[model samples]
Target: MKEQPNLRDATYQEEAAIDSNSTSIAGLVRQLTREVPSLFTKELALAKAEITEALNTTKAATIGMASGGIVLLGGFIMLLLSAVLGLSNVVAPWLAALIVGGVVCVVGMIMVSAGKKKLDPAAFKPERTINSMQKDKEAVKGKVA
Candidate 1:
């Protein structure tokens, strides 16, 4: 007669097979679903904060774009108005053109000045970063020495 397999060993092998076979893709997904809600909540919160920050900054970006557009549109309209008025013949066309040109130039200069004022070089952090790097290099050299 053929020798029979040991009951305990056979049971252990069956249990291992069950363990391996039970962990299917669906089972893994269910496990992840059970554990991921907290992680999802944290990520969702982070995303919301980032979105809020972007939303807050959007107004400033929009205002900047609108202001630039308005400046361009205003210059265009002024030029058109000047041309129309000059053609209507109350003043000499050349004189009107000169006056309009001067006005436009003045407005452009004012806008440029305003833009320069708004652009603060001090706000950039490059100098601070350079200083920190210089300090770090000195420290590293001292350590090597």
Candidate 2:
């Protein structure tokens, strides 16, 4: 994909050109007043686009995982049935089913626990957008100071 140019970079270049070309402080201030609002609107649009992209990615991945799980579930059920049948040859049928069921339940609990740990809110955080906003915050502070 072709990369989009950064709005901030373009804005900075425009500001630089304006600073050098303009002879009056009033003209510079007037230009800044007009640009700041547009800059903010562009930044918000960029952040919204980033967030939407992240959500779309997560949605696609979830759908794919759910589809794969449905297929795997059918195979898993057959495998479990085979295990129970094989064990039944060595033990009572009831005992074999109980044994397999218990093991499967325990394994499932462990997997759920691990999955819960991995499901931290941070996993879905918009790190790039947050970092960009932080940089912008610091730049604004520097300008103010």
Candidate 3:
């Protein structure tokens, strides 16, 4: 399958030829002013696209973790039961079972929480677009200076 082009990494390439249209510095400024926002809009769209793709991937992983955690709990229940039975000799049966179940539930919840953290939108900040925009800003400032 062919890979889709990443618009965020695109650069404008132009020949150093004079335009037949208005060549005044004001004209250039006008064009830049018009194009800058368009470029930024495109960049932002690209960032959103990238984040969406990452979200799909992270979603799968998060789902896997959550499901695994659930399955682990099912299996852990059996193990805890055995543990409770063994501990019953030392402690009360009900107390032992409660303690074991509580500990296992906490561990399972922690795994689910870790998965939730991975799915956080904040975690998917568009690094490439941010860096590109920063460079663009610096270059524009340098030109103005």
For each candidate, how many residue pairs have backbone atoms clashing (under 3 Å)?
0, 0, 0
- Would you give me the overall lDDT of model 2? 0.82
What TM-score, computed on C-alpha atoms, does each candidate reach? 0.36, 0.72, 0.67
Whose lDDT is higher: candidate 1's or candidate 3's? 3
Summarize candidate 1's per-residue lDDT along 20-53 as a digit string, tens digits.
7456765445544554576557555655665566
- Lowest lDDT block of 10, candidate 3: 12-21
Residue 6 in model 1: lDDT: 100
lDDT for predicted candidate 3 compared with the true structure:
0.77
lDDT of each: 0.66, 0.82, 0.77
Cα error, candidate 2, residue 49 (Å): 1.5
Writing each residue's lDDT as its tens digit, candidate 3 over 1-145 gives: 9999765544322222214222666656765686799889988998998888888988898689789889987997788778999989999999888888888789879977986775566778888888888988997776455
Superior by TM-score: candidate 1 or candidate 3:
3
Q: Using lDDT as the measure, what is the rank order of every candidate, best first? A: 2, 3, 1
Could you give the candidate ranking by TM-score, starting with the highest?
2, 3, 1
